[model samples]
Target: MSDPRTPRPTRNEAPQWQSEDGSLILAKCEDCGEPHYYPRVICPFCSSDNLSWITCSGRGRIYSVSVFRRAEPPYALAYVTLDEGIKMMTNIVDCDLDAIRIDDPVAVVFKDRNGIPTPMFAPVQG
Candidate 1:
């Protein structure tokens, strides 16, 4: 048996599938200077392979959310629009449902699930 005081290891922190380094999902188009997500081999808009990955600020707002009472008994699925103009679907953690609302500020947090780094969002502190 292991020490009870030690926190249980999660999948993402299991030393096998942890991200090599934090990287923002980014893609740049030649026709425009804006960056996009859902990484692709070529830019969807300009058909250019001049895409480059960049680090994200990891800040965003709650675009939408839904409380899952039946599926997970107090779980929430939310859409967060990143500060960089990209939106991602993630879970909201570290706060209560009553406290979450549309347009609420949030910060990115990495959760380890079976050695996979899953992105989660927490309410931003003032």
Candidate 2:
């Protein structure tokens, strides 16, 4: 089976939602007013079809993390809890591996992947 963490192949067609600045696009339910990640046509919370896209604040805190020490350059996989109450699994980058901690404030950043913008997180710089 393919690892779920692996990103899907880039689509040939233009995305329905595109961000020029690499900001997150969130799906919000018009009925319940709850925002969710991994935008879906139907709201996961209320099963409402009235969903709309919104730009995310891109600020969150690390909920959990695992460092892959065996990887050639080392990397971290983490679940981040966004300020809007959505949690997403993402890679943490641009910081010392030994210093990462749960609840560390993080901000979204994009990495270029075969011409597609992939979202990742890094410790917020002061």
Candidate 3:
């Protein structure tokens, strides 16, 4: 049986939605200098079509987190503050829940989810 969590391979084309692997590409408005995620045809901030995708550093720190004890298989969810000053909600992986803490440094790790690369974070090794 095929694993249900396998990510589909991307074809030789640009993705309609942003890649899930923490590629860290976002649209910045050329007009108002605002950064937006979930790539759009127009800037939500100033309604400008003058936008460009830019890659960002994937390093971030845990802004807040919660351990799920009684919900849907129980996993750690967190708000990670990216180096670009954007706070993104994501799952913390590749580490023990006991090791997760607020302000702990994390680096991006791409995980395949049903054939789509998803952005996750792990503890920054020293």
Using lDDT, give the best candidate's number. Answer: 2
State the local distance difference test value for candidate 3.
Answer: 0.75
Candidate 1 TM-score over all chains jointly: 0.73
Ranking by TM-score: 2, 3, 1
Instruction: Give the 10-residue window scoring lowest on summed lDDT in candidate 1.
Output: 9-18
Query: Best by TM-score, which number?
Result: 2
Error of 3 at 113 (Å): 0.4
Winner on lDDT (2 vs 3): 2
TM-score winner between candidates 2 and 3: 2
Shift of residue 116 alpha carbon in model 1, Å: 0.9
Tens digits of per-residue lDDT for model 1, 79-107: 99999988887889889987789999998
Instruction: Report the candidate with higher lDDT, 1 versus 2.
Output: 2
Q: Estimate each model's TM-score.
A: 0.73, 0.84, 0.75
Task: Residues 1-126, candidate 2: write the lDDT tens digits.
Answer: 654544664332124234677777777889999988776668888999897777889889999999999986689999999988899988999999899999999998877655556778999854
